[model samples]
Structures are given as C-alpha cells and as structure tokens.
Target chain A: MFYREAGQFKSTYQTDQAIFPIVQDRWFMALVFIVAFVVIPLVADEYWHQAIIIPFLILALAAIGLNILTGYAGLVSLGTGAFMAVGAYSTYKMSTAFPDLNIIIIFLLSGVFAAMVGMVFGAPSLRIKGFYLAVATLAAQFFILWVFNKVEWFFNYSPSGTITAPPRELFGVLVTGPEASPVARYYVCLVFLVVFAFAAKNMARGRLGRSWMAIRDMDIAAEIIGIRPLQTKLSAFGISSFYCGVAGALYIFCWLGSAETEAFDILNVSFPVLFMVIIGGLGSVLGAILGAAFITLMPIFLTNAPPMIGIHLAADLQKHIEEIILGLMIITFLIVEPAGFNRLWQIAKEKIRKWPFPY
Target chain B: MSAEPTVGRKIGDVILDVANVSLSFGGVRALNGVSFDVNEGEVRAIIGPNGAGKSSMLNCINGFYKPTEGMITFKGESHHQMETYESASQGIARTFQNIALFKGMTTLDNIMTGRNLQMKKNFLWQALYFGPALKEELENREVVEKVIDFLEIESIRKTVVGRLPYGLQKRVELARALAAEPDMLLLDEPMAGMNHEEKEDMCRYILDVNDEFGTTIVLIEHDMSVVMDISDRVVVLDYGEKIADGTPDEVRANQRVVDAYLGVQHD
Candidate 1:
C-alpha cells in the first residue's frame, strides 16, 4: 500500500530526525516526485499543466501559508487573498521598473513586501483574539485590495488598471510569458515547491514551530512558560505571508500571466484555500498539499467528465455545478473527517499495514 | 542543613512588592489598596476565601490586569504599568487557576515552547532550518528532556495534553512553566482540581522545583494543610485586606486568621 509506513527503525539522531523516517513513505514520496518531474512533463498536455498542475502547486503553497497561521499559530486570517495580491502587484512593479533584473529574485523579494504588510495587519492580534482577530485580518484583505485598486502606481498607471506578466528568461531559457515552454515553467514551480515544502517540514518539527502550536493551544500558558506571544504571532504572520507571497508571484509569472485587483476576490479563491486547510489536517504539513491537490483537481475532473460523456452543459451551469459540488464536498469532509485528507490517508495506510488480518 | 539564617533582614529583601494596589470594575472593587511582599527563593502562599482579591494580585503582577491605582516593583524595579509581554521579558512566569496547556500539542512540544523567550535565532535561521536553528533546537531539546525526566512524564512525552488525565495535565503545565527557567514562578491554584494522590504529586513537584532550581514561588492555594506544609511564609487575606502575614505557624496562630477560617464566635 502507498500509505504503509511500517518497520522503519532509526539507528542515529540524524536518521530519527529525518523528515520522513518510514522506508515505505520515503519511497512513495520519491516515486511521486519522479512521476511529477520526469513522467508528467512527457505525458501530460498543455491543458493539464495549465489547468490542473499549475493551480494545484500554487494552491498548495498558499494552503501551507494559511496552515502556518491558522493551524500552527492558532490565528485565523481572512486576508490571504489580499496578501497574494500584494505579491502579484509587487512583482509586477519590480519587473516593469527593472526589466533587466532576474525574475527569480523578484519573486523572492516580493515575498518580503507581503511579509511586511502581513506583519502590520497581524499587529492587532496582540490586543485581540479569536473571532476578533479574524475580523482584523478581513480588514487587511479589504484595505490591501483597496490600495491596489485605487493607487495608480500599483498598476504602473496603466489605463487598463491591470498588470500583465512580462516575458522573462532564466539563464538564457524562456521561463515565463506565452513563448515559455510548459516543461520549463513546471520545473521552476516544482523545484521551489519541493524545496520550500521540505524546509517547512523541518521548521514545523523544530522549536519555533512548537512555539506557534503552543500559542494556538493556550496563549496564557504559553506566556507563563516565557513565550512572547507578540513576537511568536508576528513571526508566524511573516513566514506564512512569505510563502503566500511567493505563490502569488508565481501565479502571475508562471500560471495566470496577468493579474487584476479583483483577481483575489474573497469568495472565489480565499474560501477555497481555507477549505483546503480544513479538509487537509489543520496542524499537519502534508495535509496542506493533500488538501490543495484535492480541491484544485476535483473541479477540473467534474468540468471535463460530463462533456466527455455526451452530456453538454452551458458555461454558467457548469460553474454553478462546480460550486455546489465544492460546497457539498467541503461539508462532507468536515463532517466525516474534520482532520482532513491527511487523516483519511493515515487511516487507509493503517488498514493496509494490517492487511489480511481485518483488525 | 546550615542553621537557618536570621529571617529578619532577608524579609526586607523583597523580590516583588505591591503597594496601594486597587482595582475596581465600575462599582465593584476587585482589589482595594492591597499590599504584599514576596522575597527571593521563598515559597509565599496567598490564602483567602473566594473574592478576597488573591487572583487580582497575581494578575496585576503578571500584567494581565492594570490596577486602577498602585505600583508593583519586581527586583526593585517598578512594573505597575508594564505590559504583559514586557513583564514576561522582565523574567516573570506564571500558570493559571485552570489548566491552560496547549490541547493539540504533545507534552514535549508544549514544554519546548516555554523556551521561546530564550531562543535567540531569527526568521532567516528558522526558515532555513539549518545552522543555528538546528543547534538551538537540539540544545532546547536537551533542556526539555531534562524537564520530562524530572516530572516523570517520559512515558507520555508524545501524548497530547488534552487527552491526558487531569493530574498529568497540571504536571505538564508545571513542566512548561519550569521550561522557561523563570526567576519567579507564579502558580494560581496549582493543585486546584486534584485528588489526594495527584495533590501529593503536585506538592512534591512544587517543592522539588523550589529546592532543586532555587526558583522563587508565589502560589495561590485553597488547601490549608498543603499551604502550611510547603510555604516558607503565608499571607492571609479577608475582604481584599492583608489579615495576616508571617511564617505558617505564626499565621496559623494569629487570631484574625483563626477567625477568618473557623468563626468570629470561635475566636
């Protein structure tokens, strides 16, 4: 079974400390990576890459960001969409102003800008908590998007009031824009996603991650134990925003190729990402990826399957059906396994490990 | 043990001094002109009936509640107007009346979090999860492991505090507090909801923490026997006024304390 993680033993601290200590799980991950990087590029067409893979990667990154805030730090934020807009606009401004600069540097630096904005919004958490903090973040969402829309400089004073992704090259290879190859774009996203995912995994298992969880669980107790709540909460905001910012940059640079102030509408994108975290496991890193993939790919399958089966539906009807299905799926997951897809995967693996013995 | 040093001069060496502290919620006076002193390396017990302003005193010290009028000095430095975070930075650690452990985290993770204030690494190292972050994590783990061993919570190190029995949760909370290695440990009813066995366990831990780490303890407790046994000195309150303050034996013998406990008629 792909989920089985049995009979793995550690001989040293480093081996015990390895991110995934189970032999079966390690092999499963390796195989998944091989399929994604090597096989999918060869077999999958442009539609799959654009519609399913790219969106899935970007959503997974954003989910990770949200999970860091809501799940680990126990701070709920409704401003994720706004943070993404910051990344997109910041990247657009940087690239447009300095067309000769490296695109990769712009993506990373844009994340810092988002981090600063997130920190400012996250300041209210020091004074407020729970539903109040959520409202404060919502303020950030509206305020940031409002600035992006109203401020002419944010869009380079363009008459369209929208920023377009400029054609960019990485190491003499076209990595973005219409002329860029799908394989190259996919590779870029894959490399960043894998590296950051691993980094996040390690961080969550370390001291700082523990601090976030502690604050989430009980701020009073965390404080008595010498944890500075403001510092820890702010740091969670900063790191989570960093991840979301990078994803936002990639959304315009690698996938969407353009952005608008309305690009981060609260309902269409933000709620879906929140659903990903809730349906994935709240506190587990793997759950973020699982939740992102499930939410990202399901609608694609739903949209394409009916048309292929000689049942044609209008565009509006298809969109409505997708929303309904998404809503129902969210409710079902919340009821059946509030811990999210990670718990489901765990249960499946547990059953498989005890195969032929019905326990 | 060496002859107990004269307790007189040292009594004046107050680690925490609350003077003329008064807090009111509209017409209700939670604390009114309350005054007290806590000395270094001493187990100071604050005992009173319900609504006697014991908790308000702790809240003021920890910066949870700002007293309407008064000053609190810790280590000769006034902190009557300090923020909670600032109080923490100034080396104050405290537990709540109710068990406030992080429910979703394991005992180990909860305790490691206590070391948050001590960690000096920045976001760059934390995000990289290499270099100083790794070193810091390992170092903190060593200290956390020691706490786990001290508390005898090794078996349940990985178990979430929420799922543990009440006594274990309380112990884990203490472990988390001790993980901070604080100069002063404020325990609000550390043994509030425990059975005899659990109370005994908690009492032993409190003493060990005091004796081994030399941590100053200021506790609010309801049990007279536990307070008499563990506290170096006792402060008795009645209606937010300091009714009695002295060694446990001395306070127990005080007429006001006797009246507050038994009855005015008995006194």
Candidate 2:
C-alpha cells in the first residue's frame, strides 16, 4: 500500500528524524518521479504541457510560498501577487540586461529581488498581528502593482506597461521562449520543484520552521519560550517570497512569454493560488502540488469534455460552466474536508493500507 | 543533591532589582511603585489576592508590559526598558499563565521551537537545508530530545500538544521553556488547574529543574501551600504594594499576609 511504513527499521537517529520515515512513502515518491520525468514526457503533447502542467507547477510553487507565511507563521498576506510581480519583473530586467546569463541563474536571482520586496512589506508585522497584518499585506499588494504600472523602468520602458520574456538557453540548449521545447521546460520546472520541495521539507523539520509554527500556534508563548517574533516573521516572509518569486519567473519565462501588469491581478491570479492552498491542505507541501494539479486540470477537462463527447456547447457557455464546476468543487471540498484534497488522498491511502480490517 | 544553601545573602547580591515600578492601565494602577529583589538561584514566589497586580509584576520583569514609572535591573543591567523578544534572547525564558503549546504541532516540535534563540543558521543556509542548517537542526534536536526525556514525555513525543490533557499540556509548555536552557525560568501559575497528583508531579519537576540545572525560578502562584512548599523565598503583594518578602516560613507566619487573606477587624 502507498501509505504503509511496515518492516522499515531505523537504527540511527538521522534515519528516524528524516522528513518522511516511511518506506512506502519513499517508494511512492520514486514512482511519482519516474512518471513525471519519463512517462509524462513520452506520452503528453505540447498542448497538455502548456495548458495544464506548466500552470500546475507554477501554482503549486506559489501555494507553497503562501502556506509558509499564512499557514505556518499564521501571517496572512494579500500582497502575494505583488511579491510575484516583483519576481517576474526582476527576472525580465535581469535577462534583458545580461543577455548572456543562464535562465536558471535569472530565475534564482529574481527570487532575491522578491525576497527584498517581501521583507519591506513584512516589516509591519512587528507592530501588528492577525487581521491587521492581513490588511497591511493588502496595502503592499496595491502599492506594488501601482509601482509596476507607474514606473517605466520596472517594465523596462515598455509603453504598454508589460514585460516580455527573451529567448534564453542553458548549456547551448533552448529552454525558454517560443523556440524552446515543452519537454525541456517541463524537465527544468520539475527538477527545480523537486529540489525546492526537498529544501522546504527539511526546513520545516528544522529550527526555522519550528519557530514559524510556534509563532503561528501562540506568539506570546513563543516569545516567553525564547523565540524572537520579528526574526521568525521576517524569515517566513523572505522564504515565502523567494518561492513566489521563482514561481513568478517560471510563469513568465516558461508559460506566458509576454505579460502585462494585469497578469498578476490579485483576484484573477493570487486568489486562485490561495484557493489552491486551501483546497489542497494548508501546511502540507504535497498538498500544494496536489491542489495545484487538480485545479489546473479540472478546468481544462471541463472546457474540453463537451467537444470530446460530441456535444458542441458555445464557447462562452462552456467557460461559465467551467467556473460553476470549479466553484462547486471548492465549496464541496471546504464543507466536507477543510484540510483539502491532500487529506482526502491521505485518508484514501490509509483505507487501502488497512483493507479488509475496516480501520 | 547538595544540602540547601543558607538564606543569609544580603539584598545587595540581588540578581533582579525592581525600583519604583508602576504600571497603570487607564484609571487603574495595576502595579503602584512595587519594589522587590530576587537573588541568584533563588526560587521566588509572588503571591497576592485577585487583582493584586501579581501578574503585572511578572509581566514587567519579562518586558511584556512596559511599566510607566520604574527601573528593573537584572544582574546590574536595566531590563525593565527592554523589549519582550529581546528579553528572551538575553537568557530569559517563561511560561504563560495560560497553557500556550502550539496546538497543531507535536510536543517535540513545540519544544524544539524553544531552541530558536540559540540557533545560529542564517536564511541562506536554512533555505538550502544543508551544511550549517542541517548541523544546527541535529544539534537542536539532541537538546530538545534531552528535554523530552527529562520531562518523561518519550511516549507522547509525536502527539500534538492540544490533544493532550491539561496537566500534560502544562508540562509541555514547561518543556518548551526549559528547552531554551535559560539562566532564569519564569512560570506564571504553573499549578493552577492541576489535580493533587499532577500538582505533586509538577512540584517535583520544578524542584528538580532548579536543583539539577541551577535555573533560578520566579513563579506566580495563588496556592500558599505550594509557594511555601517549593519556593525558597516568598514575596506577597496587596493593592499593588509589596506587603512582605522573606523565607517561605517567615512569609507564612507574617501577620500582614494573614490580614490580607483573612481581613482586619477594627474595634
């Protein structure tokens, strides 16, 4: 069974202390890796990669970023879209300025820029908490988007207040831009996702992550127990922004080669990512990925199903139906299992593991 | 264990000296010019009736609620003016009157958070999750595990603290504070909701912590028997004033303390 950890003995403290101690989970992860790296590339088309996989991966990263701040640190941020814009715009500028730089370097560098912006926005958390902090982050969201719209240098003097991704190569192979192959982009994204996921898992098991959790659970108690609230909150903001920035870079460079300020509009983009986190499960990394994938694919399937089934619905009507279906699914998930799709998956796996026992 | 030390040290050797401390919330004076001295390695209990400003005194000491009018010195350094977060980094750890375990986290995670002040890894290393970050996590885990074992919570190591019983949750909160390895431990009513057995267990733990770790404890408790039993010294407050301060036996026998609890009759 996918959930079983039977017969795995940990002799050392290190093994026992791993983020995931179950042997079954390790094997399942390996299987997932194979499917993502090998089978999906061989079977899936460019349409599937662009319309589903890329958006899924990007949204998953964004959800993870928000989860770090909102779920673990208990600091809600409405300005996630602004932080993402910082990432996208910074990446665009970096790539344009240094045309010879590798795409991966640009992506990582953009995260640093986003981290700074996030820190600036997160400064008010020291003075305020909970709903007040949430409102402060909303201010950041509006302020950042305002800068993107008003400042010409941010968009590299573009008349339309939009930034365009330049063609980029890594090791003499095209990985982004129109000339880049979908498989290459998919692999690059998947690899970074894996690396970041591993790092996030480790961090959550370590001191910094524990600090965030402490602050989330009880800030006063955390202080009395020797945790500095400012440092912990700032760290959460930095890391969460870094993740969002990288995802923003991925969104512009890998999926939508050209984007305007409206690309990061809070209602259209940021709220959807927030919904993904809520629908997946707030504090779990795997839940972020699962929620992203489900949200990404569900809309595509709904839009395309009528045509496949030989029922030709009008395009506008089809779009409306998709939204209605998505809304219903979100409400149903929230009402039935607020922990999201990840919890459902976990329960299903547990049930399978305990088959015939009614556990 | 060594024999109990003599209580003959002068007030001049005081590790914590509060001078003219007063905290007013609007029209009410929570603590009005309250003054006291706590010596090093002494278990000092602050006792008072309801609304006697006992908690306000502790809050001021830890830098939670800044006093409007006085100075508090710890080891000859001003601490009253310091921020609450800074107080923790400066070798102070405390438990709240309310049990404050991170509800969603396991007991181990809650305690590990206490070691946050001591962790030296930066954001870069933390994000990378290798090298110094990994080493720090391992080291911190070792210390946290020691605390867990010390508290005899090995079986419930993975249990989320909120799901635990009240006594165990209180113990977990203490474990979290103790994980800091502080020079001083501040406990706000550690035995408030405990049953007789739980209270006994907690008293043993408190005494053992002081004896084994050499941690100076300052606790606020209403139970006079507990204050007399475990504390080396007791300080009583009434109407935001320091009524008495001495050895537990001395404080117990003080006529003022009796009058505060039983009230005075004027013929």
lDDT, each prediction: 0.84, 0.84
State the DockQ of every prediction: 0.47, 0.59
lDDT per residue for candidate 1 within B1-267, as digits (tens), equals 111332331333678888989988899888888888888878899998888889888888988888999999998898667666667667778888888888998888888777887788876687687888878877887888899999999999878788999888889888888888887899999999789988888888887787777788999998878888888888888887788899887888888888886354221
TM-score of the first chain alone, every candidate: 0.95, 0.96
lDDT of 1 by residue, A45-127 (tens): 99989989988988899889989998889899888998988888999999999999999999989999999999999998989
| Regions of model 2 farther than 4 Å from truth | A1-3, A158-161, A307-311, A349-355, B1-13, B262-267
- The alpha-carbon deviation from the true structure for residue A198 of candidate 1, after best TM-score superposition, in angstroms, is 2.5
Candidate 1 TM-score on chain B = 0.92
Cα lDDT for residue A203, candidate 1: 74
Give the Cα error of residue B20 in candidate 1, in Å: 4.0
Candidate 2 interface RMS: 1.5
Model 2, span A1-359: residue lDDT tens: 44566778877667878766887777878899899999999999999898888788888888888888887788888878888899999999999999988889989999999999999899999899888998998898888989989989988887777798888988777888777899888887888788888777777777778888888888887776667888889989999999999988888888888898788889967788888888888777888888888888899889888899899988898899889988998898799999888789878987988876897
**Residue A182, candidate 2: how far off, in angstroms?**
0.7
Quote model 2's TM-score for chain B. 0.92
lDDT of 1 at A290: 94
State the lDDT at A28 in candidate 2.
79
